[model samples]
Target chain A: GDKVKQSPSALSLQEGTNSALRCNFSIAATTVQWFLQNPRGSLINLFYLVPGTKENGRLKSAFDSKESYSTLHIRDAQLEDSGTYFCAAEDSNYQLIWGSGTKLIIKP
Target chain B: GGIITQTPKFLIGQEGQKLTLKCQQNFNHDTMYWYRQDSGKGLRLIYYSITENDLQKGDLSEGYDASREKKSSFSLTVTSAQKNEMAVFLCASSIRTGAGQNTLYFGAGTRLSVL
Candidate 1:
């Protein structure tokens, strides 16, 4: 069984549209982190949450430790937002359990 | 803002050859980690260091060695490269915010291919 499961293995959306990505965890996660891996393979940190919601620019993220899930929402998606999104949960042991990731393509 | 730098953006090796990857961080983070990502797959941890001279093995630690000789640098060595093996090696560093909680920042990654 996967400790961390991500939804919508792939997603394609038009520019300026809004969409959401999610991660469900079967482990006891204490914290969660979201990242976007650019085409060049550089991972850009999006948010770090501790059982709450955070918003930055056009991105918003929320983590509910009790519910064992996390969500990332993108508003007015831009072409530069096309990339792979990954979320990792820090377990009780402090080990990061990673999700398979969601490949997002923003079409013009 | 700080950065994490991984050397040799690309690496090619022969089967059974020993290969090494290096990472340097300017964030002054106390913890560093190494992860391997195969094509179309999630990342698997290789090794992590909490501090200088302190090493911890992750699930995929077998056949790999790591060193944290200095606070700002961590390195990973593949004992024996497998033919046709291909993966991206990522290096990350994090600072602890609270008890058992951390946020990781990663480098551009190193692409490895073995022939």
Candidate 2:
């Protein structure tokens, strides 16, 4: 079963544009985390949230545990932002489930 | 400001052959994990350790063996490689916040292919 489902499996953005990626959880998530997998295959943590929202430079992430959903917003997309974005949900039982991921391609 | 090092960035093995992957972390964290990522799919946990000698099996632990002999190092062994199997194995470590909540620091990943 897919506990964590991500939308827009693939996305393309022009330079200087914006986009949003989403993840919906079927289970009760107590915390959420977002990561970016770069071309070098390194998984970098972008945001770790308990609830509410957080903004890090051009990237902003929001998690609503009550609604069982989370979102990541990218502002002024740059070529360096071209990578795969993933969101993972953590339940009270300590189970961490991941979404399939959204592959974002930033074009020139 | 520490990094996770995964040895043999790329691995090639024959069917039915035993293979091993190694990971080393310098963050002195208390928790470590192993995950497998297939093409177009999310990562699946294979193993995790809470401390130097505690090992826990994950959802995808079949056909895999793990060891946490030392606090800074963890190793995974493939019981028997399956033909045509290809996947990327990621190693990560984290400082326990509470219960199981953590922000992971990952290695560059080990790309494996079976012949």
Query: Residue-wise lDDT of candidate 1 within A21-66, one digit each (tens)?
Result: 9999999998899989888888888988889999999999999998
Cα DockQ of the candidate 1 complex: 0.79
Q: What is the lDDT of residue B45 in candidate 2?
A: 96
Pairs that clash in candidate 2: none
> How well does chain A score by TM in each candidate?
0.98, 0.98
User: Which runs in model 2 stand beyond 4 Å of their true positions?
Assistant: B98-101
Looking at model 2, residue B86 earns an lDDT score of: 99
- Sort candidate 2 into its docking category: high
lDDT of 1 at A25: 97
Query: Runs in model 1 with CA error above 4 Å?
Result: B98-101
Question: What is the DockQ score, from 0 to 1, of model 2?
Answer: 0.84
Task: Give residue B72's lDDT in candidate 1 (0 to 100).
Answer: 98
- How do the residues B10-112 of candidate 1 rate in per-residue lDDT, one tens digit apiece? 9999999999999999999999999999988889999999999999999999999999989999999999999999999999999886565577989889999
| lDDT score, candidate 2, position B63 | 98
Which lDDT value does model 2 have at B60? 99
